[model samples]
Target: MELAKRIQPTMTRQEQEQRDRKAASNRQLTALLGKIAIYVVTTTLAIIFIAPWAWMVSASFQPIGDIFDWPPSWIPENFTLNNYTRFFEEANIGRLVLNSTLVAGSVVIAQLFLNSLAAYTFAKRRFPGRNLLFVIMLGALMIPGQVNLIPAYLILQHVPLAGGNDILGNGGHGWLDSYAGLIVPSLSSIYGIFLLRQYMKSIPDDLIDAAKIDGAGHFRIYWQIVLPLCGPALAAMSIFTFTYHWNDFFWPLILITSESLRTLQLGLALFVVRNRTVWDIVMAGSVIATLPILVIFLLFQRYFIRGISLTGMRG
Candidate 1:
């Protein structure tokens, strides 16, 4: 009887151990399956997102015939750099690139300065009719750029002070087809001002107070204190402005009639005129045009994220 009692207790302990091991195994299996499912879903989404860019890169290297082949070859049997070569050599792509760089660069600089200055005033300064002025500026954001296009063009055409327009606004040398015409009008972006103002408002009042106590003027406080803290917002605005101006097609197409003055987007459109579309060349040019943006994003991606985070905090 004693032996049987001891044996029963040992058997029970073994059984309990077995049960615990089984439970642990089941839990591990369940966790592994969940991880695998998550990985599969994430990989699928990544592939879907990357597929178009992959196809673009592949098509850019494909031979002229393979580009429009019936089956749509994803992998080219004969890859060549002829498209790129032709782009640089025959198409005067360098000049188009220069035009894009100059226009985008100038717009970025001008918008940054103007928008930041305006935002500082809106955020920090106590001026007469300030709220009314800000409301008017905000209202401008609601007006579509297209609606103002004609009026803006007319204004540029009759710019009174510069461009040789007399006070009477007659027979003046209009800024049509000029870089200044393309740039100056775009400089006053209400969205940029609003974004910067939102960011500026989030900054602690103590910092500005300290600067003021130190005998700093509005300009010093702005340039030294506010602007440094606004790096992320400024970067975000810079990216937005640069990309918008760089990819601007309609406005440039309307304002710039001279081929030499044509931006890259406009110049690329000239490649496909009246039903003659060279798909390979067009895609190649698109790839080229896309490179700058890609480079910019990669370089400023950290700043961009920081900007977004700061903007969200303000909101």
Candidate 2:
């Protein structure tokens, strides 16, 4: 009886260990399955997002006939530059690219300068009604840009001393069909100012004070000290401004009348008009237009994220 009791306790101990091992094995399997499911779901989502761009890139190389194949080819069976060749031949693609680069480039440069300066002033300086002014500026963000289009158009149309407008701004078309019209109204970017302001506030005040102690003027301090420190913010703003302006269709469509002055977005519209649509050539143009933005984002992605992170932090 004593021997049997001792053997029974040993058996119970072994059973407990077996149960523990089995439970641990079951947990590991469950965890592995969960991880696999997560990876599969995320990978599927990635493919879904990437498919359109992949198709766009693939279709750009496809001949016009192959573009409409029943199953929709993800990879071109045979590649040809005919779509690209036709794009260049039929459209002023080079000129359109030039126009887009020029306009987007100019806006980026001007916005960097103007927005950084305004941001520095708002962040570091104390002036009368400063908070009120800033609040009003932020309030503008709540209003839809489309809502201000008419007012902006009227203002641009009636500007004095340029575009042949008299003192009353009631003569020739003020900046109409000109680069000035395209660029001027865009120069005062409240969003850019706000973005830069948040970033600049994070900069240490000691640096600005030290510069002031050296008898540096506000412009000198702003240019030499503050501006250089704002590289990441500037890059982020430049990319955003460039991308937005590059893809701007409505503003350019409304303002620009001459075909030669048309931006890339407007020029691409010539593909799908009245009765005809050229899918292959249109896809090629899309790829061309999209390539710059992708390249810019890839190059400056880190800086862009850093700038956004800095903006979220307090001074």
Candidate 3:
């Protein structure tokens, strides 16, 4: 009886401890499972986002025949540079690239300078009707570019005094189908000005006052002090401006008629001119056109990220 009682008590205590340990293990297991689920969900989302780009890269290398084969392949079985070669040789794609680069570069430079200046004035300077002017500028953002396309085209076509036209909006060659037509309308971007203005407002007033006290003129303060500190915002605006101009199709399609003056985006459209389209060549041209932007982003990725983050901070 003594042996039985002693053994039973010890067994009961051991069983209880074992049960507690198992409960603790179960709690740990639950936490681990939650973390694993979160990780899986995150990875799945990343794959979804990356899959399209991966497909594009794969498609660019794929042979024409294999592109539409049963059960789409992720990897190109027979990779060839023939598409790229054909694009460059047949389409004069190099010239198209040059045109895009020139237009995008000019837009970026002009927009950055003008927008930054306007933004600085709105943010720091005291002037009559400043608030009212800013409100008006903000309101311009609501005006769709499509709504003004017809009027803008007409104005360009009838621009007086410069294109050898009289003030009556007639008898001039008109800027239509020219580089000037392509660029002039986009010179002053209201959104760029607004973005820069918001960013500039975050700067402390004391810095401007101190700079002014040090005999810095308005232009000097803007050029020397303000511009340097606005690297993030400027970088962001540059990327946006560059990308927009580079990829712009509708405006160039409407304005530029000459094959030689065609931008990269417009040049790519020429592939579909025939009743039957060459998917391989078309995709190849697309790949080429997209590469430059990708390269640019990769090269300036740090600035792009900084710009985005900086802009978000103010918002």
- Tens-digit lDDT string for candidate 1 (1-315): 345446567567667667668878999999999999999999999999998888888888887889888888888789898878877765689889999989989999998999999999999999899999999977777887779888988988887655677876657657878898888888768878888998899899999999999999999999999999998889999998898899989988888888888899888887656326666776788899899999998999987777667556644
Per-model lDDT:
0.85, 0.85, 0.84
Q: lDDT score of model 1?
A: 0.85
RMSD value for candidate 1: 5.0
Q: Mark the regions of model 1 whose C-alpha exceeds 4 Å error after superposition.
A: 1-27, 161-167, 309-315
Q: Give candidate 3 regions above 4 Å deviation.
A: 1-20, 161-168, 273-276, 309-315
Q: Which runs of model 2 end up more than 4 angstroms from their true locations?
A: 1-11, 161-167, 308-315
Error of 1 at 47 (Å): 2.0
Across residues 25-48, which tens digit of lDDT does each residue of candidate 2 receive?
999999999999999999999999
- TM-score per candidate, chains pooled: 0.86, 0.90, 0.88
Clashes of 1: 0
lDDT sort, best first: 1, 2, 3
The ten-residue window of minimal lDDT in model 2 covers 1-10
